[model samples]
Target chain A: MLLSNLELVPGRRVVKHLGLVQGSTVRAKHVGKDLFAGLKNIIGGELKAYTELLKESREEAVERMVKQAESAGANAVLNIRFATSSITQGAAEILAYGTAVTLE
Target chain B: MDLILQNFDLLLFAVLFITGYVAGRWNERRHYASIRKREDEFAGILVFTNRFPPPSTTRVATVLVSGSAVISEDFFKGVVAGLYSFFGGRIRSYESLLDRARREAVLRMKEQARAQGAGMIINVKFQTFAIGGRRASSVKGVEMLAYGTALSPVGA
Candidate 1:
């Protein structure tokens, strides 16, 4: 399915608006990774592990969102947006939301 | 020798402080240099925050592109930020950290657009999170994510 974080896809016209669809997931860091991050705080640089973790979480969220859009019979998701919130000390929630629409 | 052994905690703090300062500065310099170089290389791909793509007669396909970067605060910057909080003044050290994270994220997004043969990206959005920062004191790092729609020519 085509995904665009814009009101209208460049060359595609929306024939139907299936309403809003959203997907979210809460993820917690592993204890081992948490300990590694603590040590990484000392020298201050890129945290590849954390980066990868967040990336995976976001992709999962987007995947779920796409599934929802597909179930709604939408050919594409438009005006997509993402949100991240720390739900607790070591956990965060990643959210993806957009308007599901059929394009022509 | 006796004094050093007696004040081992203080000695260790001193050693950590020096190492953090030195290494953090070096890393920041290198990162900025690389960012600048990449920025120059990717200058052809324009990025805009407007929600609408520019008018074009040629058919273009819009696709979602995104990039994220996670940067951790060094020991020295964290200490300095702590003191700055106490003083109620701007934390200059963290300014650079956030700057680097944002630029790096954008660069990654641009790289993806370039790979897809897109010359411009529009409707850009940014989301930032403080990882492990449930408490004010334990903000280990910041994560920056940039996302947008990339318009690539359908047939070239």
Candidate 2:
């Protein structure tokens, strides 16, 4: 399935709108990674562990959203957007949502 | 020995301050240099915030592309920000942090588009947020994500 974060695909027309589809997941940092991050606070730089973790979470959310679109008989997901919220001290939720549609 | 024992906390604070100052400065300089060089290298690819791609006669395929970066504030920067908060003025140190995060995110998105043989990205959107910043005095970090649709000719 194709994905675009725009209202309409440039060269294609929407044949059917399958309404909104969304996926979300919540994750907490590993104890070891959190320990390393604490030390990194002293001499700050990129947080590779957290970055990778969040990236994976986001990809999973997108994958689930794609699955929903596929099940709905949609060929594409449009106007895709992402949201993130910290659930607690070490946990966060990543969400991916978009309008599912069939293109012609 | 008595003096050292009594001032152990002070000594550790001093050491952490010095290390943070020196290491954070060096890291910032190196990251800025790398960012500049890579930006120049990626100048050939076009990025835009327009909602729609330009009209094209040839068949083109479009796909979503995204990039994200997370950076933490050093002890020195956090201390500086604390001081700035007292004065009720702009926190200059954080400006650089946010700038770096945004630039890095955009660069990564461009890299992905390049890998996909896409010539341009449109409708680019950016999202920025603090990671695990709820607790007081916790190590604070900012995350920036850049996402958009990349357009490339169907064959190439």
Candidate 3:
């Protein structure tokens, strides 16, 4: 399915609008990664563990969103956006939301 | 008990402060150098607003690109930040932390765009997530995300 933040697809015409759909997931860091991050913190560059954590979280969120759109009988999702919130110590929530649509 | 406790805490802070200053400084310099170099190389690709589409493009594809960076605050910066808060002024140490994370995210997005053969990226936006923060777990770090829709000529 096509996903975009833009309201309209460039080459396709919007045939129908299927309302808003969303998917979200929460994740946390483990002891191993925590130790790694602690060591990396001193060096002050990109933390790969956390980067992978967030990336996986975002992907899962988007995957769920796609599932929702598919079940809704929609061919595309538009105006998709993401949000993150700290749910607890070591854990974060990632949310992906968008309007489901049918385009031709 | 009180005297021993005090000494131990000071010792811990001293170690952390020195480690943070040295390692953080080195990392910052290295990242800045890399970011600058890559930005220059990727300058030709277009990154802009989503309001307009390239006129010559026959077919358009929308792609999602994002970069994530987690920066941890060192013991030294933490102490300074704690004290600096009372004065209500900018904490310079945290500034570079945030800067590095943001730049790293943007560069990742640009790299993704390049890999997809996209000439430009539009609707670029940034999102910041505190991994371990106040009211949550005590891990001091941030996750910066830069994402956008990449546009490339489909027919070409």
Which portions of model 2 show Cα errors greater than 4 Å?
none
Best-fitting candidate, scored by TM-score: 2
User: Model-by-model lDDT, in order?
Assistant: 0.90, 0.91, 0.82
Candidate 1: deviation at residue B56, Å? 3.8
Clashes (candidate 2): 0
Q: Taking the tens digit of each residue's C-alpha lDDT, what string does model 3 give over A20-93?
A: 99999988779998887776655556777788888998999999999999999999998889999877677788
Per residue, candidate 3 scores C-alpha lDDT tens digits across B68-144 of 77777665666677789889899997888798888878888888989989888888878988766664236677888
User: Which model, 1 or 2, shows the larger DockQ?
Assistant: 2
- Candidate 2, residue B37: lDDT: 100
**True lDDT of residue B53, candidate 2:** 82
Q: Taking the tens digit of each residue's C-alpha lDDT, what string does model 1 give over B1-156?
A: 999999999999888788889989998999999999999999999999998876753788788999999999988998899889898989999999999999999999999999999999999999899887636445489999999998888886
- Computed on C-alpha atoms, the DockQ of candidate 3 is 0.63
Off by over 4 Å in 3: B1-6, B54-58, B135-137
What's the best-to-worst order under DockQ? 2, 1, 3
User: Poorest 10 consecutive residues of model 3 chain B by lDDT?
Assistant: B130-139
TM-score of 3: 0.91
lDDT of 3 at A96: 98
Interface RMSD of 1: 1.2
Q: Per-prediction DockQ scores?
A: 0.80, 0.82, 0.63
Q: How do these models rank on TM-score, best leading?
A: 2, 1, 3
